[model samples]
Each structure stands twice: as C-alpha cells, then as structure tokens.
Target chain A: MNVVGRRTLTVIALVALAIVGALTAEWWLSQSPDRPFGHTQAGHVLGWAGLLLMLLVLAYPFRKRHTPGQRWSKSLFQVHIVGGLVGHLLILLHAGAHLHALIPVLAMLAMGLVVVSGIVGQVLHALAFRTMNEQRRLLLHQGLPEPEVEARLQALAKQEETFRLWQVIHGPLTVTFVALAMLHIGGALYYGGF
Target chain B: MTWPPPFSMYPVLLTATLVLIIGLGWASARDPESFWAPGDLSVHHAGRMSCTQCHEPFRGATTANCIACHADATFISQPDSPPQIFHRQAARERARCLTCHTEHRGTTARITTDPLNPHSEFIFRVTGTQSCRDCHAGVQKPGPKYGLLNNDAVRRLVAKGKGAHGPGRFADCFRCHAGGRTGAERGS
Candidate 1:
C-alpha cells in the first residue's frame, strides 16, 4: 500500500525466489543423482554465464562513484539488482547441490550472504530515500521557508546515514565472495581441465 | 529523527565474515587437502593422498596415470565384459579416464560410471548402437564377440528359454561374470 510496505514486499519476493531456486536445485539433484547436471558441459556454461553477470553487476558501483550524475544511473542500478539475483540463481543451478570441496562451499556461502545483504541494503536505501522525499513534500505543504525545510531534512539525513550502514556488511561479503570465487575458478581450471 | 534503527545484526554479521575469511585463508594455506579436496578418495586409491599420483599439475588426471597400474591385456581382450568393452572403446578414442571414472567421492563410493544404467550414451557413441542386442546379436550362440556364451553353464542358461534371457534383463551381467573368475566359474 505504502512505500515501506512495497519495499518489504520486494524483499520478501526476492527471498522467496531464492528459496524456490534452491528447492528446485535440490529436487533435480535428488531425481538424477547418477547423472548430475553439474557435471555436464551445459552446467559449466551456466557457471560462466552467472559469473559474467556478477562481474557486470560491479559496473553499477563504479558508475555511481565515477559519474553520479550520469543519465543512465537509475537504469544501471536496476540492472545491478536484477542481474545479481538472476546470476545467483544461475549459479545455484550450476552448483546443483553437488559441491563437495571446501573452497566452493565457502564461496557459495559468501555469495549467499552478499545477496542477502544486498537485498537488505536495497530496501533500506529505498525506505530512507522515500521517507526523506515524503518529509520534504509535507514541509513544503506546511509553507516552511526553503532554508528551514533544508535544515529539518538535515536531521533526517543522520537517519539516512544509519540506513547506509548496510554497506559495511554488504561490501565485505562481496569482497569475500569474489576472493573465494576466484580461488574456486582457479581450482576448477587446474583440476577440472576447463 | 531516524524512522527506524540500524539493523541489530550488522556487527554480528561483519564479525562472522571476518572470521570466515581469516579461518578459510589459514586452512587453505596450512592444509590444502582439507580445504580443496572435493571429497574423500575412493577406497582403492585411499592410501595415495598425493594428487599428483593420478593428476598432472594443471592438466588434471591423465589416462597415462590410470594405465600405469591397469595395463592388463584382459581389459581389451574381454569383449563379453561390458565394462571392459566400454573401457577399450573409450581408450581407443583417447577419452580422458576422468570422464567416466571420477574419484574423491568417499571411500566406498562407486568411482567408475555405470555404463549400462547411467551412461548408455557411451555404448551408442562407441558402437553406434543403443540396445544390448545391437551389439550382442549372437548372445544366444557361442561366438567371438560374445565369448562368455561359450561357457557350458551360460549355454545351459541360454537353453532355459526366452524368459530368462529377455532383453534388458541381463543388465547385471557382472553378477555372473565377476572379475578374475574364469568363464566356467563365472557362469557357475
């Protein structure tokens, strides 16, 4: 109904999608243990595709930092969010509940954490932004002077600072995921001969 | 004022991530086998922890390493044996042994892929045939291609009737044709 409600629903939908993807993978593996899809050529292709999407998602942060005023910033952020979730789903399919090595297992865990934190960060950012805009609109309606309105928004800005703190967790998890994923890729190349 | 407080789990999650990273790094550096091994080695190869025994550093496991120990002639000579036939065909094509014989799947896990059950494609690829009858057309009679039929006990089974020797029923050929046993002993 409202902004926060919509944001909460978005978070729930993302989490539900992730759970469904995981369950589907488990079901597929259980049905065909003798011929695991993860061992197939298609599986490797999916893994690479997912990894590429994840790498592309990093462009959003780079663009935001280097050129915040870019016309395509909003579109790039949308791509980042959608690409990240789809990439993670593809990877979950590629893995197919077949991971046995510690490196891959750790990488998957880190990736999961990164996705979870990213979703939380997205919701928090949207809430903070919308709340500020709503407050500013109400202040203008109340006929507050422009300077006074600006002064009041500064207090809300401190609350926004707290919301941005999700980045502290999200950023580190992403770094950990990247490090572990690189190691996994190295191991696959060295031992898998591909 | 802040409408909502910051996530309470932020500090806990950050600490967990740091611990995971540090712990994994230390384990990987100190004991790579524990950190990198896909799973426990099969019982036949359990004693050899050195990956280099079967694997080349960057090229993965090579057929040369597999043949170094399994260079027995019977693997090629025994056409009646489905596994041996599959292996012979795979070797002829220079297929990597790892394609079908993956290791590090627990001590008692079946390492070799079951061709008849799971990988009928191997047979089709090698013989251009899909069914057992396509290759074993003369399975009822003694012949060069199906030498195991020459055994008297097997011949007797053939005489028993069509019910016992129906298609797809002989999937477990190894139940009788146990490795290292003579054809007579195998059929008995």
Candidate 2:
C-alpha cells in the first residue's frame, strides 16, 4: 500500500527466503557424503556461486555511476546489498571451519572485511537518514516552511554523512578480496585445478 | 567538509588490484607448487618448482602427466617400484592424482607419508606387526598414543620385539597395539 509497508514486506520476504535457503543448504550438506567444506563438490559450487555474487556486488558501483539520478539506482543498491549478503553466506558455508589454503583463506578474510564494512556502512547511513528525517519532522511541526525545513534536513544529512569512512574500508576490502580471489584462482589452475 | 567522491580512490584501488594480481601471477608462474601450494608436493616431485610439468593449463595434472613421465618400460619393468606401480595402477583404474595426492597442503610430509598409519613415523622400521609397547611404554593405557620412539631406542625395541614376539605372536600387534583399538590386545 505505502512505501513503509512495501519496504517492510520486502525485508520480511528477504529474511524468509534467507532462512529457507539456509535450512535447505544445511539439509543438502547433511545428506552429502562429505561435509560441505571447500574441498567437496558442493562446497566448490557454493564457492563459485559466492564468487559470482561478489562479481554482481562489484558491478553495483558501476551500475550506480552509470544510472545516476535514476530511480532504478536505488533498486540496484538494494540488489547489491542482497547479493553481497548472499555471497557472504555462500562463502561462509563453503569455508565452514576448515580454511586450509593460504590464498583462499586470505580471500575469505578480505570478503569478510568487505561484508562487515558494507553492513556497517548500511547501518550508519540508515541511522543518519532516520535522524535527518526526525529533525525534519520536528522543524515542520514547529511551523517552519517546507523549503527551510528541507534545507535544514540537507545540512544535517551533510554533517552526518561525512562519516563515510566505511567507503574507505569497504572499497579497499573489495579490492583485496578480488586480488586474493584472483590469486587463488590462478594458483588453483597452476596447481592442476580443473 | 563532505567526504571525497567514492570514485576518487578508484585509480588507487585499481592500481593496487593490478599490482597484486600481477605480482601473484609472476611469482606463481615460476614456482606454483611452492608459491601457493597448500602442501608441499611429495618428495618425488618436491624438487620440481614448475607446476606445468605435471599440470596442464587450467585442466590440472591428469593421469596423462603421470603417464608422460612413467609410462615407459623403465617404470613398468619393476613390479615392486612404488611410484611406477602406483602410476600404472592409476592408469589401469583411470584414477585422478587428486584422489591420493592433493597439493597445497602447506607441508610436504603429507605427500611423503601417511598420516593415519603411526608406524610410518618410526625410523627403526618394524618388518611386521609387533607390540607397540615394546618401544612405547605406558602407551597401552586408555589415552592418546605415546610420543615417537627415540631413534637410539628404536633399534633396541625392534630387536627385543623381534626376539620376544617372533613372527606369529606379533602378527596382530597393529590390531590391538595400534592407536585405535586400545592396549588390551598388547603382549598377546
């Protein structure tokens, strides 16, 4: 019906899907002859899927840049977040507890850092937006005109959004992940990986 | 002031990414087995730095690689030859090298020796199944196996066990005295 209702529904749906997916993965792993560790076929599939998802997540920045000032950019951002979360889950599943290789372990660590920093960025941005909205509502209630209220909100948003250090963390971590992943892939191939 | 545009650092990140990828490729190309290998290759292949010797580009080392090296009469002539026989068996069975010999294990020990069999660690080398307690005192108690037998003591232990157990009595020593079944079967 409304934006809040739509957003709430979307979040609930995503959570439900994630829970179901996790349960299904757990069941599949249980039935497998081997644990779904990275060495197993299922684990390899998950790792590949996770890498693909990371590629999608990496594409988001380009998507946003190319589609600047477009409404679809917001949807793309949401996709990026979902893709990143799913990718992280797949990777964690693939790794399980037995992270043995050096390059792959480093890649997993970089992926972890990227995912954590991304979540931090999301939380910080949400907090800033909420605070700005609350301040705007307060200004509006005090009988300020819409234009001045908007200006005040923008100023508050500017101040709060300045703490975008998450970008510094997120971007470099992504780069590191990509680099390590490449190294892992290259190493695997050189060592006779099919 | 506002933060710099997110894209501002793109050049740096790109450069770093390129540098790391290139650096890895350069190092790995020269010595892939030791560079990023999980474990050291078996002693048989340990001296080899080039992964390309066994592994094909992207497809990895197939039985073909083994065949390439050991398929000739030189390897086949010796029935008891461990490496050549293993390669021949693999070829007959159409087995992948990875089934028995996985790489990048971070240590060459895995390729050289079996982890499951404890007797492999002993340097004295028992000819047959013998009481482990002959060397490893107090190992028969219900706990972890005793530490490795001392090199000097190994010779003495082997001689003593051989003399005491002879061949028939010690046949099932591994069945009881080996780590898993407990020490109840010792000195039978």
Candidate 3:
C-alpha cells in the first residue's frame, strides 16, 4: 500500500483497539456490582507490571538520542509504541471502574492525553520522514548539484519541523502523567499499608 | 502550513490540563480530601477530615490508630462473633483494622463489613471448615443449628466451663465482663 494508505490503516487500527479496550473494561466492570477486582492482589500485580512497562517506554527517547545507529532507534521506537499501548491497557484494567478518587482519576486523564498526543506525534513524524526521503530522491533524480540538493533538503527540513511541534504538548503531558502517577502511588502506599 | 497549524488548540488544551493538574495538587496538599480522598468518610468519621488522624506516615490506618479511639470493650470483644474475637486477639500480630472496616467509601457506606469479599479466613479459622455450606448446610431447614454459636471453641469460652457465663444467663456479656482490658491496652 502507499504511504497515506498505510498511515490511515495504522491510525484506524489504533483507534479501534482503544475503543475495544474501553468497551471491554466497561463490560467487565458492569459484570459485578461491587467491582472489587481492582483492589485484589491480581489487580495490584497488573498495575505494577503496567507501571514498569510504561516506565520502560522512556528508554526509547533516551536510546534514540544516545545510540549512533538508525537500526537500534527503529527497534526502540517499536518497543516504545507496543509497550505504551499494552501498558496502558493493563493500567485501564487495574483501574477498573473505581472513579471515586480525584488524584487517580486525574492521573488516568493525564495518561490518556499522553497516549493520544504520542500517537499523533508518531503519525506526523512518520509522514514527515517519508516525505523528506521522497523529496531527497526526487532532487537527486533531477541532477541537482550536491550542495544545492543539500540546501533544498535543509529548507524541507525546516518546513517539516512544524510536524515536531506535537512534542511540545507530548513532552509536558508525559511529565504531568509521571508526576500524577508518582503521587497516586505514594498515596496508595501511604493509605494502603501494603 | 500542515494538518496542525503552528498555533493550534493543542497548545491551549495542554495548558489547561497543566493548570488543572497543578491546581489540584496544590489544593490536595492543603486539604487532601478535596482532591485525594477516594470517597467521603462515613458520617461517624466525617468530622475527622484530616487523613493523618487515622493514618500514620507510611503505615496507613493501623489497628493502633483505630483502637486509640475505640478502646471500649463493646468495639473489641464480642465472644459470640468469631471474627471480632479473632480481630481483638490478633489486632497487633495478624489482623489489621482495614481488613474488615474500610473507609473512604462515601458517607453512609457500611464500614463494618468487607464490601469486596467475605473474609474466607473466618470460615476456615473459626469453623475449621472449607466452604460456607459445610457450616450452613442445614440452615435452610429446621435441622441442626450451625456456625460459631455451636463451635467448640466459642462454647468453651462463652458458656461451657468455669469462669464462663452459663448458657441463657447473660444476654449481654459486657454487663458483667466490663473493663476486661484489650490487647492494645495491654501494649501487646
């Protein structure tokens, strides 16, 4: 499939997965009136596992900046995407339908925002990268001088920089989510006695 | 110009979320119940809004904190109730107040019962039975009485031997057994 078609399919699949997950959680909670599974030992284990996976997602950005190879960056990106989505699903399960606490509810909202913003950033980045590569190939085919082609690519890069503006929102949302998550954990520990 | 303009609503929305999160944190620090409490405290405990009143740093609402206020024998000792006896005996060693009475479930919430699941240990430890049906087998019909009232341990402690109030005599154990000192009072 073409780039646009592939991208569209990816976005649709992600949205569909999110919707299905949400509906499943709702159905599971509705199965029981007390909905006490979130407080069970199994629920807590799921929460801890999800939290660890989400924390691992941060390694992608760190590795991307430090690793001097494209291959490793690509693999880490995949890990970041998969780990984030799966971690989010586990967290949603751990949360169940217990929406009584304000701090935890806020943390969930922040987490959702972070995931949405990250998905948006991922799509835009993919599009920009593909467009830049295609433009570079076209410039080469046109028999432009190396220096001239380089200059044109630099200009294209500048234009593509607009796509990165999603990071401005994504970065802060991530920090907010982390902070709220920490507070939620601390509160649980303080009040849970376990 | 791209799908997302340089100035989009994304930034505005992000700013609002940040502001709300920060405001919530600040408010919670000042009064945790406003934004941190899972639910409202039961009506009896409503006046004690401070989390630290029952909660100790890193320890949660310990049985010590609970017994601090509820030192009365009425709250601790009920020989007829195996759960109460177990809790009173093991308050320091094994049982926690939160095991049975969980708060922050909204005012009027039943804090006495385990809202999540029945305490399986009660049946296992008190009745020495695995399933509820083992003890409540004939509860449906007028066959044989079951449960803790007929348990040997309870019978021995309540109305069988010397120093035990005879059966059908003391309807209220506390009437004569007042001030029998709790485990907490003994500093055990």
Best by lDDT: 1
lDDT by residue for model 2 over A165-186, one digit each (tens)?
6665676677778878877877
Reference-based lDDT, each prediction: 0.69, 0.60, 0.67
Encode model 3's per-residue lDDT on A57-88: one tens digit a residue.
99997776577455547777888999988898
- The weakest ten consecutive residues by lDDT in model 2 chain B span B108-117
Considering just chain B, what TM-score does every model have? 0.44, 0.48, 0.42
Candidate 3 displacement at residue A71 in angstroms: 6.4
Kindly report the fnat of each predicted structure, to 2 decimals. 0.46, 0.43, 0.45
**Which candidate number has the best DockQ?**
1
TM-score of chain A, predicted model 3, versus the true chain A, to 2 decimals:
0.82
Better of 1 and 3 by TM-score: 1
DockQ-based CAPRI category assigned to the predicted complex of candidate 1: acceptable
* lDDT tens digits, residue span B86-145, model 2: 556656677665565544433323332222223332222443324444355544232243
DockQ of each: 0.27, 0.23, 0.22
Q: Note each model's CA RMSD in angstroms.
A: 8.6, 9.7, 12.3
Candidate 1 lDDT by residue in tens digits, B1-188: 22122588668767987897788778776766666777778767887556666777677778888888777465766655455676677777888776667777666445666444332333233335544544444343333335233444445445543454444444433343333122423234
Over 4 Å off in model 2, which ranges? A1-36, A71-78, A96-101, A159-161, B1-22, B29-31, B72-75, B79-101, B106-188
Better of 1 and 3 by lDDT: 1
Docking category for candidate 2?
incorrect
